[model samples]
Target: MPAFVGAIKINDISGSAVVNIGDVFHIEPRSQTKTFAGAGSFNTGNYLRVKNGYSVTHTVDADNVDNSNIGNT
Candidate 1:
């Protein structure tokens, strides 16, 4: 098993796993990913550090936005 922070609720399909606000997901010393999950809002960031031998799949709520400043701004 792996270590995780924040909440992971069962039957909650519309959310990202293994990430939370102000928390940095470090895949390795040189690489890392961070996520900020806001309430009633969906904020997410996925940094691919390993660059190899890694795979992930998740469902995000439509209400969630990766970031407000990017893409739209």
Candidate 2:
């Protein structure tokens, strides 16, 4: 018995006070956007890149969205 509730609270509702009144379904609200420019490599591993230097560097951190990016909208 709930549609769109907004301010008109009643007391004596007890423990947790959550009156959602049902029918507020906004599922699949997941957003993950990534955009990069100049310096290639997004979500990487083993990228030991050194430009104009007499040095040694090592980098590795790989897990570029293995699986399951969430479904069902």
Candidate 3:
């Protein structure tokens, strides 16, 4: 998981959810610090470093429908 600067809500109803860099998801920011480091990278006191590329995606909907609020209802 990427280093999120703030709190994030990840709703995985199917019990199988994967998140990857470059992949977009609906996020409700609960704090002012919402910045995030790049994939396989991190920031340290104004210094940024990269390691390895780790990315993946989850199946929110098998039918590919816009189910952004799947578990809210």
Candidate 4:
């Protein structure tokens, strides 16, 4: 099994803002195309990654935001 990192949870009823470092996120692909054989399509995977560092600030709208899980080692 793969080692799990951390998780975070955010509860925002309203507001638009930017994301800074130390922010955790849950990213999922809406759709994917198979470019090679044996490669599956429309597969959904939930992966978590922390913003250890970033060159610039990341902005997002209300539609592109979600809660995260943290403190999981």
Off by over 4 Å in 1: 1-56, 70-73
For model 2, which pairs clash? Answer: 2-21
Tens digits of per-residue lDDT for model 2 on 11-47?
6765534455558655342344444333333345676
Total clashing pairs in model 2: 1
Off by over 4 Å in 3: 1-38, 41-45, 53-62, 66-73
Highest TM-score, which number? Answer: 2
Best by lDDT: 2
lDDT by residue (tens digit), candidate 4, 8-46: 566663333343345446544333332332223335678
lDDT against the true structure, per candidate, is 0.43, 0.50, 0.46, 0.42
Q: Write one digit per residue (lDDT tens) for candidate 3, span 1-73.
A: 4555566576663433345544365654222222344554454565655566666544244564432544432
State every prediction's TM-score relative to the real structure: 0.14, 0.24, 0.19, 0.18
Which regions in candidate 2 have their CA more than 4 angstroms from the true location?
8-22, 33-60, 66-73
Ten residues in a row with the worst lDDT in model 1?
27-36
Per-prediction backbone clash count:
1, 1, 0, 5
* Model 1 score (lDDT): 0.43
Model 2 weakest lDDT span, ten residues long: 34-43
